[model samples]
Target chain A: MASIVRKPKDLIAGVLFLAVGIGALVLLREYDMGRASRMGPGYVPAVISGMLLFFAAILIFRSFRGPQEVLAAIPLQAPLAVIAGVLLFALLLRPAGLVVAIIPMVLLGMFSISRTGLLSAMLTAAILSAGSVLIFVYTLGQPIPVLGYWFKG
Target chain B: MIELLGNLQIGFATAVSLNSLFYCFVGCLLGTLIGVLPGLGPAATIAMLLPITFGLDPASSVIMLAGIFYGAQYGGSTTAILVNIPGEASSVVTAIDGYQMARQGQAGLALSTAAIGSFFAGTVATLIIALMAPVLAAAALTFNAPEYFALMVLGLVVSVVLAHGSLIKALAMICLGMLLGLIGTDVTSGTERLTFGSNELADGLDIVAVAIGLYGVGEVIANLNAPAEQRTAAGKAITGLLPSRADMRRIWAPILRGTGIGSLLGVLPGAGALLSSFVAYAVEKKISRHPHRFGHGAIEGVASPEAANNAGSQTSFIPMLTLGLPSNVIMALMIGALTIQGIQPGPEMITNQPQLFWGLIVSMWVGNLILIILNLPLIGLWVKLLTIPYRYLFPAILVFCCIGAFTLGNSVFDVYVMIAFGVLGYLLKYLDCEPAPFILGFVLAPMIEEYLRRSMLLARGDPTIFISRPLSAVLLTLAALAILAVALPAVRKTRDEALVEE
Candidate 1:
């Protein structure tokens, strides 16, 4: 079971890296440059991509040759929540402004951890958002946008 | 000698100013605070502060930033000793003996020894910079693009020694990082290579985003998944913060050796504080009378690595200030700050901007003094911070990471990029891959590419340029020899043994 889990990830990552390297090589061919003597625009990319291919091949070969060591599996929920929270924050940052965006983001993060309750998370988020607004916007006078209603005249 | 004294006097005069002193204090204080907090290191702090330094004079800005660099080194050891979690990669070695000391009820002694050793090393390193800056700068003048490329190659090769896992995996991660570094618009051609038509990616992935995502957020994710029992506090008791007479004696030789090793290795591009600590620990173990004490509560183990880390943090500036070449990501940000201030850092900097150069040197000493003063009194306060529940702490870290990433470009895209890298970082961790070499590869790739191109151009596309130029030839030969040495069967066998032990 351990060997089965480890093999798939290694194989996938190896294939992905090789694909990216090949893609880079393909893109390099599109760049127009004069005939190469010692160096051209694509020379370094070609060399780097070639090396990547070589390494990826080695990784794949090694995976097949041995039973890879397996570690404990990562829990899925918290990471997923964190990613979702970050994406939500990014989406709402401009339209909702700093305070509104940050409050939800903080709450989502706190929820993901499972130690902090709803009331504590909300209270913590509000306090932190206020503090950040004061420090960044009021004290330092950075150009960050505040909530429209709270904007200074 | 008189000239040196005069320079020192000028440096003191500049550093003693109210504004410079204030910034230095602020930098050191903030650095220690961040360092005590797990997952935040000098690189993130410096990068976040880069834009703020734009309005200040170059000398004052540099002084504050330099303080943060060494201050973090000192602060990182505190956490490593107390909590068994290293705040930075350099502190990993400190964790070996430091955590053992904590477990054995000698946390206070370990912390004090580390702090004192760091202070001593900091003082001596500052003197080395003051005395040796001119000579080093003069020597660095001979380096051209080919030599620079060769130097970077050597640095990349040296970083492979950092990985305790499969060399193949380490090398693969490095190549992966180099490829990721190429995802933005090409500077020379003005054409987007890997942007995938996203306009936000035209400027490339922010280093802040990648670093924070990989180290900070990924660490949080990993920690949250750990079993509840393991997450429970150790609740170790504390005592006086002084080492015994024998403890001091055991550490003295290691501290001196670390200082010597650190000061020399610190000048090399890409091998900065972190590598110095690793090398220092290895050397100390090799030379120790009781090598078995290393992974236990050995004072020398903590003292040597911490001192070396701090010393290396200070001297890394030598390359950036003297040769206009940044040794790491933080120094790269500093270059941008200097350029915005209309100051070019090179051999001519000393002659053209004496006040700035000397002022920075002077400020470093003040910064070290300030860090020691601020840190010793604040150790108790920092210790209290560790008692805060991880649930509350992790959210705050996430907020800071997000804000820091967003502030880098005022674009939401950087935040997304950070999250992506966070996932990649977690994946890498699970796969037993070291992220440091990848960072080295990413940071050095562009410079390497530019140098290779220029070398060829200078030689009129001649294939023999690498071998024809005597300096380039020598550097290339060294790189080749290093690769060959590592690849040799005898060396490989030893390296494999070392990897198993590590």
Candidate 2:
């Protein structure tokens, strides 16, 4: 006998919504819920969370009814790498300035593509960093620093 | 009619002034540049440029800003078609079939059709604004809290109709968006609701951060997940820049229909521009004999939504000009620009400052014409953007996204929010939940909450306020009917059938 694993996508989405709803409800509990006529800060939010929980329950319940859409195969590397690149840019922006910050950001993003070489990636990063400095700092006068304190000035 | 023509004549004279024409050209060019880029959108662009326009006279200031408004709307479609990166909510529908058309070696056809459709829609919408400005504004003035609330409901339901995925997932996405929207300090009671002890969350999530992440960065992540060969740019497939006669014939009716829908919806308060394109696409799909062609490479799909969004953006000005009520965020910025000029926008704008009013109107037509002339040539350059390798392109796009987010508030906090949403957006896509509805929900949440609270308080906590007033009742009834239409078995069967056929 085959065990049922119907609609894994729906099942996952249901659990996701369920977590979001429960988390929202738990967070909202810290605030005061006023009466309907005279609402406090938490009145509308409490209602929204309640509704979210209700809908989430429905989503979870329906996930078990029958098999529907199959879960799509999603690769984890590209999205994570791109996100890491953005995060690294953000972390470095204030400390290292655009020229220093852009290299790793661009390198990580270039890593998302399979065929990129280290030399070419660094070359592209250098070009983009210089171009950005020219466009944003020198031309547009955005007031961004060329080198923050972290750099050996 | 003669009076209308005379007003337009006066408008032409004022708009024809050298200063007005020059400012208008500058605004349109700037708007197009930002709109084509993935990370930045028109709102942030306008906010950044707002101070620069302060030194100019009122007409030039408003005219330049207005040019940016519509020009961005036009340029946004170019990005949507070529890269599946819809920089604006209005361009999201266009990306559905527009991007597909690109993959089929019809990128040029899609872009040309969008331009032609947008031009036609802009002309018609401009005429409508001139002809029926007073009548529509007068009608719009009657909207109270309850009516506005009902309209928000209708808009949300309309967004659901436009989603091409599972209904439950879309609704869940919308609710999730609303929950996320409630993250900032509550304007009422001066209470901080969902900040989670972070000062950055005090203003709630920035819509620009959300928009850039969900659509722009999220799309990059999605694209990168595919195999290298499968993820090739569509620029290599381009054959020509003009649509065939057959394609034009297919899209014309949809274009007209979209224009009508957009013009009418644009006058309503709150999220109207975002709603019009979705509603138009939904209507086209329902009535199409070959519904399967949709979400594939249907010419009608590209033509209709493009026309609708442009028309909607144009007519959304009506409320701001005549009633002094902004229908969308860009219009709100325009109001700010007007106030900065020490001018109050309302009925008095026409009677007291006819020169400014008429000049702005006529300048819009001129600006639209300029956009077409500016955009068509740039299509070649924009298409070449697609030819760049993904490795280089992703880094450039990532940098643009970072700089744009940082510049919006000059803080890196917004970039963090963008990263978070990028992850959420990727996850939502994996689950078949669309970011479009979620974004719309974020846009509409504050307006919806304010209206709901006001309506209830005004009615002494009576829920019947939504059904008591005739207009509110009618609007709520229509919203309910729309929900039913989408939810009913027969309609679901047809939609499902279309999905299966596709």
Q: Identify the candidate with maximal TM-score.
A: 1
Per-residue lDDT over B394-495 for candidate 1, one digit per residue giving the tens place of the 0 to 100 score: 677777777777776677787898889889888777766777667767766777878877777777777587777777788778767766777787987776
Tell me the spans in candidate 1 whose CA falls farther than 4 Å from its real position: A1-9, A37-43, A148-153, B48-55, B103-105, B227-239, B242-250, B268-272, B282-296, B329-348, B493-502
lDDT by residue for model 2 over B305-340, one digit each (tens)?
888988888898886787665555566567767876
Candidate 2: misplaced stretches above 4 Å? Answer: A1-5, A151-153, B1-114, B227-364, B496-502
Candidate 1 chain A, poorest ten consecutive residues by summed lDDT: A32-41
Give the CAPRI class of candidate 1: medium
For candidate 2, give the lDDT: 0.78
Fnat: each model in turn: 0.44, 0.66
lDDT of 1 by residue, A4-99 (tens): 444655676678668978888887786555444445456676778889999888777667656665545757888888878778878877777778
* Per-residue lDDT of candidate 2, residues A46-148 (tens digit): 7777776777777777776674556567789888888888999889988998898899988988877778899999999999999989987786667666787
DockQ of 2: 0.60
DockQ of each: 0.52, 0.60
